[model samples]
Target: MGGKGHIFRKKLFQVGSEYKWLGNSGELKEITLEKRTGVTKELIEKRIKLVTTGIDYHLGHRNCEHFAYFVTGNMPRSDQSIWHMFTDHDPFNIQPMINNFDQLREALLRSKHCGPVGLSRGDFENAVFVSQLDDGYYTYHLSHPLGGQHLYITTVEKAKNFESSYNSIVLAYFGAFFGRGEIFSIVRQLRGC
Candidate 1:
């Protein structure tokens, strides 16, 4: 994290002294938050002190991303944690249920005035294919043996939400469409359909 011409980060080994100053790493990407005031060095140092003293360094709950967000006066959040919450692929331990896939798909499909997307079902069976169209819109495609569907997301927020819920959506689709059948039974059902 860089601000006011200095670069620093919360390193892993330094528990109590986590904040390390790395004089100007030219790789700082500026994050613009509207109505944010200039953060003073004293304020940053205070935050760092509070964090290094009070918070235990936990990868999932309190990491560098959380520190950065906290010091910047934004709601402290870890993008990695958020991503893991959505996409942890442990089959035996799926995340909490997100039950709005059908409704979201229906809404998007109804709003977007496209006929069936030309991609074959096999092209997107295992994953949701996300791509940015020439007009800056995003497309998410998911296909099954029965059919295929795509949603044109106009905003990045919606696109991210869809992508994050992609696995759940796929699972929900199969679960609803195929019932509680095993793989062979699902295949048989599909064939019978």
Candidate 2:
């Protein structure tokens, strides 16, 4: 590994098939739909073997981007490739408070992946009309018709921080890359989030 400035490549590719909320607001659902790569478990597993050989990476060739293409079959690419930003660890690096909740809603919608970046107190009753819970949390009142209504939950503290907060709602949901034993840090899955 490059020891912070150095880039690390996987000895092989690994992904899970579990269906969890892709982002705090299910951002990946939309992106995956737009994706046209068709793959199989067998193919992915086979490619996973290549990493153990330890090969050199070349730009637009045997690089990480190309490796992703081989594993995902999706024409590998990146969104924010500049990896030096430890900005996620500092809340101040993110747009402060966001002023009003209404502005937050607009920001959320305008967010890169239609996912939320952090928690803001808002009465977004559009999802489902549910009775407020005694603990301040509320549930969707399934009485109305189903419209892909879903809810995501996280601790109140993380809702207020960065790093983890990037995927909290959905501001450019890039999966943060991390090293072993690395602590509270930012992560992304390479192709921009």
Candidate 3:
């Protein structure tokens, strides 16, 4: 564990308190980020309550940037982790569940817009693919040969939830973090024909 994770997502929410310096010579710089939505003080407090038990910390995934972006909807990013992903990691294991999968593969191959996505990492190299089945409505799921939950990506709210779940699953299983890929993927998938 690194000391940088030293302060694992400390929540600082003093509205009128003075800024106390905590560095040798770190200069204070202020910049603005356009937010997707305004975050309420009540929401911030509620989220902060989840800082300990409800939040899982990961250098590559749920770093300070993600925490801020999630709460504020500003979507500020840390490129360091992503840079490391490209230079210091294995091939993007979109997972080989795509290969040698018989039952679900056949089923999805028959669907209108079926695709694939793995839910976890270790010992589950062969997971069901996330596919879309379209009739009048579209549905996204792993369509497991044995059955699993379908994550609907039709709305920003639902997509956000799926992104959170995907982040945890990918981090826990693939040993990698998605950063903002979850949101992008959801948006892209939602736009499918």
Candidate 4:
């Protein structure tokens, strides 16, 4: 819980009823509690219970960022984990490929998990594409062979709508036959999208 410097190098362990060494200045980078609402004493108690339970820490899944989110009664997630997943270096120190829409799209298309179903790659290429909005949300577009096009905002519900109307064959970044709904669902399950 406490270390001399560089808190990331410290192993998390409970000391008696409390976590020790939490007073280090290194631990106070970006405090998110100020941005949250509906955080109550009960929520703090819940976080204390979670801490006292001796949960195993995994850097990619359960780090200090996750703990801070949990303490605020929000879903536990770590931007550090997402950053690590996309790059070899610290996110603050280097720009990751994920920041480039073209690079990210190309990388996703090359993923073994992504491709077209029942259609040739050329057909898939002409029919479907993914676009990222200025707000950072991804939108999936499908061009029908008959001349019309459908655009879906990438939310789980909208993905379901796309699935039901498109014969569940929308091209996605994760699966050949699955629609954006499947991708969003998988992301939601992972709790990091």
Best by TM-score: 3
In order of lDDT, best first, we have: 4, 1, 3, 2
Model 2: per-residue lDDT, tens digit, 94-156?
Answer: 222222334333543443323322333331233232222223322221111322123323222
Which candidate wins on lDDT?
4
Screening candidate 4 with a backbone cut-off below 3 angstroms (N, C-alpha, C), the clashing residue pairs are none
Flag the better candidate by TM-score, 2 or 4. Answer: 4
**Residue pair clashes in candidate 3:** 3-6, 115-131, 116-129, 116-130, 117-130, 121-173
Which ten-residue region of model 1 has the weakest summed lDDT?
90-99
RMSD for all candidates, in order, please. 17.6, 20.2, 16.9, 14.4
**Model 2 regions more than 4 Å off:** 1-21, 24-34, 56-60, 72-193
Mind giving the per-residue lDDT tens digits that candidate 4 earns over 28-108?
A: 233233343567878766665554232334466456776666666666667777633532222121212233335445545
Task: Point out where model 3 deviates above 4 Å.
Answer: 1-27, 32-37, 54-56, 73-144, 148-193
Q: Give the worst 10-residue stretch by lDDT in candidate 2.
A: 183-192
* Model 3: how far residue 188 lies from native, Å: 24
Q: Candidates' lDDT values, in order?
A: 0.38, 0.31, 0.35, 0.43
Cα-based TM-score, every candidate? 0.25, 0.22, 0.28, 0.26
Task: At residue 145, give the lDDT of candidate 4.
Answer: 58
